[model samples]
Target: MAYDEGLAHRLGEALGALPGITAKKMFGGIAFLWNGNMLVGVIGDDLIARVGPEAQADALAQPGARVFDFTGRPMKGWVVVDGAAVSEDSALDDWIGRCREFVEAMPPK
Candidate 1:
């Protein structure tokens, strides 16, 4: 499964100089981790955002967002935002910020 390099580039720029940011290949795409935890990811031009369980419903209500169901089962605390929704830098940043807030609050793995 080939992911979108263009989206990955935009994600990298959006993550500019963020400490503990790392890229890892997963779910047939690239995932960005914050302090060793999964934050956001680029999967075929879409964004996989870990918004946490508490924000799941709200996150799903966002434009172009849906439950992260790469497999048969849906992930309760994650959402996949369509590429169109995050085409703009600001939109991407908003999603990333939401992911950061979730990842940052968790204990070290």
Candidate 2:
């Protein structure tokens, strides 16, 4: 299935101001990379966040969030937040910010 264009657009706007961020098409969706690291993306309207391993459990506990399972197995350090949960710009920003925090801390690739 194709990913949501609207969500992808929103993600672009959200991360537009950040330096070293780029958008790429992958996994049938649009991925936002920070400093060459995948930070967030939109998968079928859901928001995929790379919150890192240490914060995975906490991020998964949030409403409308779940494991980012693609190939019948869940990926560690990532979560997919339901699109509805991020309908508000503020909510979307929050998720993006969290993902950014984790990605920024990593050594640039």
Candidate 3:
């Protein structure tokens, strides 16, 4: 499965600036890795962030956001940002921060 080249490229660039971050395509989307852990990603036009359950509430409180439900049920500690919202650098940074936070806490794989 293919994704938006433009969005993927932009996301890739942002992740690149982040230290210890890497990315790869998976599940038809892109997965950003931090220390070998899945930190954040782009699934189609949606922005998936691994914010963890503790931070999920606050992350979801943002406009144009929802739980990242990969399966039928919503995944705890993760959220999906509306693609349209990612147009701004600030918005994208917010999602990336969540992912970074998770990765920072997790032991490297």
> With candidate 1 superimposed using the best TM-score fit, by how many Å does residue 4's alpha carbon deviate from the native?
1.1
Give the clashing residue pairs of candidate 1, or none: none
By lDDT, highest first, what's the ranking? Answer: 2, 1, 3
Per-residue error for 103 in candidate 1, Å, reads 0.7
lDDT tens per residue, model 1, 1-109: 8998898988888886998888999999999888889999988879899999999999999999999989989998999999999888899889988888888998766
The lDDT for every candidate, in the order shown, is: 0.90, 0.91, 0.82
TM-score of 2: 0.96
Residue 13 of model 1, lDDT score: 81
Per residue, candidate 2 scores C-alpha lDDT tens digits across 1-109 of 6998998898898889889989999888889998899999988889899999999999999989999888889999999999999999999999998897788889888
Clashes of each: 0, 0, 2
Would you list the clashing residue pairs of candidate 2? none
Candidate 3 similarity to native, TM-score: 0.90
Q: Model 1: number of clashes?
A: 0
lDDT (Cα, tens digit) per residue for candidate 3, span 1-109 = 6666677787788878777777888868988788889888888887888888888889899888997777888999888888898888888887787777766988888
If ranked by TM-score, best first, what sequence of candidates would result?
2, 1, 3
Better of 1 and 3 by lDDT: 1
